[model samples]
Target: MGFFKQVFKSVFKNIIDLSRPIFTFENNELKFKINSEYYYTFALNNYETKTRHDSYILEAYTINSDNLFVEYVHVDNDVTWNGLASSFFVNLFKEKLPINSMKIIEKKEFEHYEFITYKINDEFTLNFIYIYEINKDNFIIEKNAELYINLLQSFQKDYKYKFDKNQDLEFDINISIVKENALNGYFNLSN
Candidate 1:
């Protein structure tokens, strides 16, 4: 349960608005929350990857209260949603690629879809996921993102960017939120 809870928190932190609608997966069924806009989704199938990276494929759907949209997604390699959106797939190599660089080897484009391939340079790798769309010629990001700092601890542990042991990893992204949205929606963790 803690694992799922972490996943939920990670998903939530990536979004800026808590008031908008959110959904989560449960017992193979999609549940929706109007106020908190929470959604829980677990990988139903392993996503296939061609690049030599420590990446995981996540396939989940946005469960809707209305039956107007597709209810089930078999295997979605990239993130998907029905709204004004934006996303990018970033590759993080275990060993910083000799000054950090990525090269796209392939790109497939269709009427309403696009997929790009990148050549990773190091051992351990992470696929930073972000996907977005343009609506009415005005592009707005439907999702906010927080990089997983835990994955970089081995690299930044003694290096020290800022903060202390007490600060949440999110502080790496936005330190101020540590006081406003403490783990429980308030500054209670310090106590």
Candidate 2:
């Protein structure tokens, strides 16, 4: 019975390992480690200060890749700073990222939270970073597009991205989350 149990566990572990993405590169290049954490509010109704923290870990490979795979390790780093949540999110634009380094692909709002997609280049290393906040209820999509276009123009002037004048810019970003109730769902029995 114990041998059977061990075999089952091994098979489960193998399955989980296979489910995770694998990384491989052909060129020898320096990889940059990206780490960022942000805590904001979701309760825009009552206007009370509430916060949730999110942390991301990103590994970059040489040569351009289509998507960025980041791991979420810590959640809710904003709980303690609840009293200042509103002001914190409102004053976010003070942060600015260097232009021409990355492209702004898309900005999305989910459940009253806003997220922006930025293009990543394998050649340009991380220099500066930006953190922008948006009010999902009031943030106009057209404004986001304007912001992206402006940023792209700056990038062209600043870095002169190596591309033909007619080439279209492209990149990918993804978001992953573990819900509050399913913190340990991976170990839970599924039906």
Candidate 3:
């Protein structure tokens, strides 16, 4: 009976493993494996900032020659912060983070939130994103045709990523949570 139980557990674990995606990084290349198939992918850390006790990071990546752009940002090593992305600054010359390095593919928005998923096909898909605080004039404008990726950081475990190889073909940005917030948030309300 014990032998039968062990076999059952092993089979169950194997089944679970088969359904999961395997990510491999070797020879400076990123490969994603799903269901026995492998895909070649390229990722870039784009931009990052660190200042003793204040900083933020910006990142973007695509897969297998696709024009998808997945971005994630961290403020003081915390995975959070989004403001209203307005089109008013579309033609502004001031380049700000994130939006400057994207090509508009699809965009979605809420009252105080705006999500833009871009595709870098050519110059036509190029667009701008201007983020500003709610009901405030303080704005961060970004838009550049040639925002190259420079410094890179290893992937942290606190991100949300979805990689699929099925026929449906869905692409999305992965948002990972930081190991911990800086000083646990000014008011001590976070971990």
Instruction: Give the winner by TM-score.
Output: 3
The estimated TM-scores of all candidates read 0.22, 0.19, 0.26
Model 1 residue 168 distance off true place after TM-score fit, in angstroms: 31
Model 1 Cα lDDT, one tens digit per residue, 22-141: 333446442333233433332322222111111111232222111111122222334223322222112112122242555544443322233333333432222222222221111111
lDDT of 3 by residue, 1-191 (tens): 99999999999888876654343334534343323333435443433322222234332222222323322222333433332224323322123223334455545333323434344333223322222222221112122211111101122224222212123333232221221225323112124
Poorest lDDT segment (10 consecutive residues) of candidate 3? 145-154
Q: What's model 1's overall lDDT?
A: 0.27
Clashing pairs in 2: 53-76, 53-77, 100-155, 103-119
Consecutive 10-residue window with the lowest summed lDDT within model 2: 135-144
lDDT of 3: 0.31
- Regions of candidate 1 where Cα sits further than 4 Å from its true position: 1-43, 46-99, 122-191
lDDT by residue (1-191, candidate 2, tens digit) is 99999999999887765543221221332111111222211111111111223232122111222222222222232323322322332222122222334554444333323444444443322111222222111111111233323333432345233322212334322222222213422112212
Of models 1 and 2, which has the larger TM-score? Answer: 1
Best by lDDT: 3
Residue 173's lDDT within candidate 3 is 26
